[model samples]
Target: MIESWRWYGDLDPISLSEVAQTGARGIVTALHEIPYGEVWPSDTIVARKAQVTEAGFDWLVVESLPVHEHIKRGDGDLSELFANYRQSMANLAANGVHTICYNFMPLLDWTRTDLEAPVAGGATCLRFEAVRMAAFEVHMLGRRAAEGDYSPDVLTKAAAWFQRASEADRDALLASIMAGMPGAFDRYDVAGLRVALAAYEGIDRDALRQNYKRFLDEVVPTAEDLGMRLCVHPDDPPRDILGLPRIVSDGDDLAWVLAAHDSPANGITLCSGSLGANPINDVPAIAAQVADRIHFAHLRNVTKDPDGSFEEAAHLEGDTDMVALVKVLLDEQSRRRAEGRADHTIPFRPDHGHHMLSDLGRDMIPGYPLIGRLRGLAELRGVISALSHG
Candidate 1:
């Protein structure tokens, strides 16, 4: 696989030289300065590519060219937004960017309740405790029918978690959940937050699935025409959150997505942390089954607790078998090479590392501190090297 790291460009506290030092040859980034739904001009693409190339790294993939809000609703100027997205993909291809990774999660992007949950090794990491999340929904934000999303036991746990939270903790929890807002519900006010959560009251898993299908129908053809691979990243926690449905969690979901578009261009990003967050996901099997359409990868892990709580783990630790999963990707790469594909290796980045070492005290984005991801990239590179040699 092409070793890469996710860079937020110049705005990221972690510099490009630091990323180059991490042993990654490629960068996954987007021009975040541009507003969503606007066309990413060819000049901007060229300039961004030049920036990464100047830093001694290739632009591996567009971490996202965001799916616009109108497109999500399939109304209110959606055609224009979709046209802009298509033009952006075409512009990206012309500028030598090939793989485009995106997500269809409504409202927030991959969300979590706690950005610094304590782990045993003295390093705190990003976490998604179902109880903390439910507490926010039921007690803090008060989303109607939020109780239906959790089982009785989980609800009990959430109630207990809320009871124990200090006022500061609850406030921080809200901030963490709303951090780096993405998709339909960014910039929500207090009343807007209520309406936003309430809006999902009747949209079940199947309805969200239909919306995703609608999205792919518009973009996948353009992606195919321009030789771009469209990879949909799975839901971060691999489950429903705050009464919202998650569509890209399991095999069945993937099957439906692939069948919906019926094109190789519409594929999966195959994020290990996202899928492995659910204990039921057979990681190796999941990768193998989706190998043909696996255009990008995000390699990371978490220590899953039975109480529906989990904290991010180092790349080599946690329940995910890093080597076994890499082996699956490697085999897929080898097979593709054998068939004379243009790009054999699946593009991957070491995702969501701990904020540790010198990065521990830095008030950077949660799970994106430099030294921590540097360590993760090194670990993943070592595992891949060993597996390739073995």
Candidate 2:
């Protein structure tokens, strides 16, 4: 496996020099400054690559080249957007960055109700609580159909939670749920969220899947031609949220996607944290099932509750069997090597670590603190070493 780190470009608080110290040679990043639906100028790609190289590291993967909303919703004539996406792929490939990771989650990226949920050892981690999300949807956002989406028990809990939540609490909850990621340009207010939700009113699971398939049909060929791999990230919570359909959630969804466009370029980013949020997903089994198609991996874990709430756990501490999953991925790498495949090794990163040690009190991205992720990387590296030699 090729160990990698996700850097949010120049503005990231964690510097490349710092990343090098973590012993990860591959940098997984994106041109976040580029807006969605725009062509990534070749010069910009070269400049970014220069930055990574100058820091003595290689830009091994594009964490995302975002898919525009128009493409996902099948709205209007997206020919221009498709053209731009293909051009971006070509530009990336032209610069020797072949592996691209992206997601089709509508409106928002990965979300959490609490960005600083308290965990043991006085560290904080990201969490998604069902009642809190329901509170935000029904009581705060006041989505008319929100009540029908959640179970009666959840609704009751949400109502209770909403009643007890103070003004500051409500505001934080709304911000936490609606705010864009670290470098995102757009942030949604209540009205904006409602408008976004309305846009997807008629698009259900099947329609969304078809839209995704359409996107693959358009972009995967370009990737194949460019010798690039386009890996779709699974839904963060691995389930439907805010009345939106999540097609890439489980093993069956993965199977459907692989079959939708059968090509080595059309692949999956095996995110254990996201899939592990749903108790039903066997992370190790899914790893083995999609071993050949997994172009990249996010090795993080989460502790789940029966009521559909979960918190990011330490890489090796959560419900996922990290050692077992690593063993499966390593075995697959060996098989690919024996088969003489050039892209035999998988690139993986330790994702969403807790804010511990020097990471606390730092104004870093929610789950991407320096010390926390360093610890995770060290732990994962240790596992890989033990498994390989054992």
Best by lDDT: 2
lDDT of candidate 2 over 1-390, digit per residue (tens): 999999999769899988999999899999998889999999999999999999988898998999988888999999999999999999999999999999988877788999899998899999999999999989888876878877899999999999998999988988888654424787777788788788998999999999999999999999988899999999988888898889889999999999999999999999999999988999999989998999999999999998889999999999999999999999999999999998899999999899998789788977899998999999999999999999
Predicted structure 2, TM vs. truth: 0.98
lDDT tens readout by residue for model 1, 1-390: 998989887668888877777888999999888889899999988999999999998898998999875555545457788888899999999999989999888777878888887766667789987888888888788765788877789888788988998988887888888874873236665567778766555667776777778888888998889988999998888887766678888887888888899899999999999999988898889999989999999999888988777889989998999899999999999999999998888889889988776777777777787877878888988888899899
Model 2 spans with C-alpha error above 4 angstroms? 180-183
Q: Rate the local accuracy (lDDT) of all candidates.
A: 0.84, 0.91
Query: Which predicted model would earn the best TM-score?
Result: 2
Q: Each model's number of backbone clashes?
A: 0, 0
Q: Give the TM-score of candidate 1.
A: 0.95
Off by over 4 Å in 1: 183-185, 199-202
